[model samples]
Target: MSHDDLERAGFKDRTRVAEALETVLGAVSGHDRTDRVALGRADGRTLAETVTAPSPVPGYDRAAMDGYAVQAADTFGASDRSPAVLRESDDGAVTPDAAVRVHTGSDLPDGADAVVMIEETETVGDEIEVFDAVAEGENVGDVGEDVAEGTELYDPGHRLRPSDLGLLKSVGVDRVEVYDPPTVGVIPTGEELVQRDPAPGEVIETNGLTVSRLADRWGAVPTYRNVVDDDPNAIRAAIQRDLAKDVVVTTGGSSVGERDHTPEVVDDLGEVLVHGVALKPGHPVALGVVEGTPVIMLPGYPVACIVNAVQFLRPVLKRAGNAPVPDLPTVEAALSRKISSEPGTRTFARVRLREADDGRIAEPTRASGSGVLSSVALADGWVVVPEGREGYDAGDTVAVENWEWSA
Candidate 1:
């Protein structure tokens, strides 16, 4: 009995465990630091201020159709059988429709009531004609029709997307105020873990790289630490090494096993807010505060690490950065096999997605144990199995999580 014992001591099911963790987080006040940053470097950053239209999207009256800008009265009696065209006002505004030529997106001439599309007009002698009646303002996109002046373009805390950046450019927002992201320190524990290059029989340490990649994806900087052993003193020293960071994330020692020393170190240095959660394969997820900075202890399991990152830690990161919490990418797919879960805890099962004849099929990945990192790499994503449910049935519609492809 260790962290699991603590987890079971407090939670009857995974739902209770998650609910309590959220409750604690809800009670914690957020710390935010907002500053203006150049839009070039703000690709994935969150906005701290709501953006309003400096000017209308188009800013003036423009044409939606390609044709001759003319007075609607000029074509009032025109029909499919008969068309009318006016060769007047070739220079009244931006030159009248002397040639009855207009391209898409050109501005409508002032005082002109409508446009006769070239496709609809036919040339008879030196004049062109509209075969159909032209209505006033029919082919014109009125000023601010697409987006009005003084309107909000985007709300605060919006995580900028490529399209969002393009829209902001349209609004002439070259820079925006955004909450600075909290730097999370990533420390991989265990004497056996080796960085990048490893000797024979020694597995390469990947927690730092994977966590760093995820942090980068979420618009946060992940500071990698030198590998430390599972000793409380060494871990404390490691925590102090990155105390300037806003959050500290440690891998390993979350479980209360004989080799687990992270919990002991956190206990010695700072209060461990949580020792266990009710989530399967990740029940030992821990959260605490060290030297006035938030600390997140993720289980060393890769899939489990990713799961809690989505469930428990991401919310805090979003709040602290004032970023728009992106919705988890998901889709409805049928289960390929019947899977069962223990009655008291939620399980995030590694799943492989397949394109079936009818729809997608989600099957559990091989090497789904908590210690399996290979399974996480090969998985399409994780599936949430709720506590208290027997399991999902074969062909049952269940939610399947997918990657958020944000560039």
Candidate 2:
């Protein structure tokens, strides 16, 4: 490859980010693999089937507080001045002018319609004085109070959290059917990549490690492969080797440089839905499908690689794993300085947030190059400049989104 070839391979018209994502996702189908796991191991897994409560929580009437159970009619006019005198019963049943001891979460005594709190009752030998009156059903937890027996707990595609697991267990659900996590193969391609010490042209491999961790965080099991040299046959062989994975992600060799050959090899193997996108710092990213598996080609630049991964690969994993994709968290802040952007391209400007007299301030990082990994690592979040806007002027309000946040 030569410089002339690179120029000839330049993108004529780049696809919009939304259209590119839709095209990539349209080629993928939801995964049908499922596993039955205990509630202890169900956290962070997507539900494969609808889950309904088998039995209502608190199946029987229970006490909501530590108190003395009594019939409401017996203590109708009880007060601090003229307390109602009742005899304490050792039996587990309460009758007229009788009280039974009960604790929180304990079953209500038989024949008891209400409970008088311990603070409102005074113990005198075998006799108890009730200072306050409670209505029927007061301080009592009825059946199905927490969850109804036929109520839907979760629907398919709902990701289970720690709290969700606890709720399921409370409803007598010891095991649940969850979707199996998608499997991903991360391949790093570059002739200059090395493991450790770099001698002149050699550089350490980091994209594969970073992308593999991101895949795991997004609920996919990732297999990190050794770096492959920048050769067409080698790249094609590497991609073919990982066809069994639900997704194949390649970092580097995605641009139109002289050594870039991943896009060509992928096109030869399968159809390339998108070659370039209207995204800043990562416009050379590509999306393709080979043998029913989605392949993502990310740029070699560290920041560009991360941006493209969050935008494309994250959603791909969610779709394959049958999980919902959530929007990133954002905070409104005033721009401390101007941010320049192309009219037709969307730019993500790294910004550091700070407290100001008026409100929060978004200060753009000084080192804003695509290759500066620390700019994004050290900053709070990035401010997205839409394709229609040219740039953001100083003091303009913008939304700084934490792209690394997971649902």
Candidate 3:
């Protein structure tokens, strides 16, 4: 936690929040491999190419009910009072004076076009009496009724759900070409950072776990690594080792402190597209490319780390997975108290929401500290104060992004 004189010199050129995000998003594209996966394992995987039905469903004309298939004209005038009298054909053919018995899903007789329910007919000796009539196509399932041949089942980049998998299976698709989830390496760096068990004054390393889980939720395979010390050589070596991954996320060491070596290491290895942003809690966020992999250096503070993950790492992961970037749900809520932000910095104020008679109410969880991770856990969503807006007064309606999502 020691600071050097050189660490006081901050970024000379800072990028606008929106521009920085855009630059990072534009630079990092998905690096997915297309491979065939069994239908059982295709759920949640994105389609690498469009899928088309090879053949029609119910491939043939068949019966749709458990009734006798008969020529439409044979039962035309059949009614309750005077039913049609017809004999069962010995050869199972629908002759002028004979009817054919069929069951549901059985193929209709060559000369039959409809089916008459058994309840509508009664047997008398060797002849049957018909009471009701059916149309030419009634009780019949036509070819391609469910799905036609050459129909597009799904487009490229479509994420398959369980229902989609059932549909694919129904259409005889046993395997599919899907874009494999990208592999991400999450590295946490800090000399005093420790794993789950921490000593006094040692910050337990949690960003790696949090960010890795977030990446996994976004359809990326995450590999969490041990914490690296604040030395430039150690940080650079870790980045080099993880360069084989599609994306590398280093938590902490992004600021200008002497202990912050991630930005310098990333810059020494490759181009640093963005070093600083006009954003609260995550101003020191850095976006760069190491070798061919996208490297994101998140702020050391847990709250800022999580905020950066949502605002920045999410899009990169989505693009890398070849999945659609879903729009986060937002709702307008009345502020319970005044919320303030710097003049030129975009602020993401965590708030706890409550339901009231008027509507939803948003109250800031904390006014001063961004490093308190518990405040983030207590918050239900965030009130995003855009850049250029100084603050909002109490009772003002503002848009808030909810954290929970229901399928």
The model with the greatest lDDT is 2
The residue-by-residue lDDT of candidate 1 on 55-101, one tens digit each, is 77787677788877777766778887765555644455423434346
Give a tens-digit lDDT track for model 2, residues 81-108: 9999999876779999898999998888
For candidate 3, what is the lDDT?
Answer: 0.85
Which regions of candidate 3 fall more than 4 Å away from where they truly are? 1-17, 62-135, 329-345, 352-364, 385-407
Which is superior by TM-score, 2 or 3?
Answer: 2
lDDT per residue as tens, model 3, 334-363: 999999998888888988888999899999
What's the candidate order when arranged by decreasing lDDT?
A: 2, 3, 1
Worst 10 residues of 2 by lDDT: 1-10
lDDT over C-alpha atoms for residue 243 of model 2 = 94
Would you give me the overall lDDT of model 2?
0.91
Q: Which stretches of candidate 2 lie over 4 Å from their true place?
A: 1-9, 356-359
Listed in order, each prediction's TM-score against the native is 0.88, 0.93, 0.81
Structure candidate 1, residue pairs in collision:
79-131, 83-130, 84-129, 84-130, 89-96, 90-95, 90-96, 91-96
Q: What is the alpha-carbon lDDT for the whole of candidate 1?
A: 0.73
The CA lDDT of each predicted structure is 0.73, 0.91, 0.85
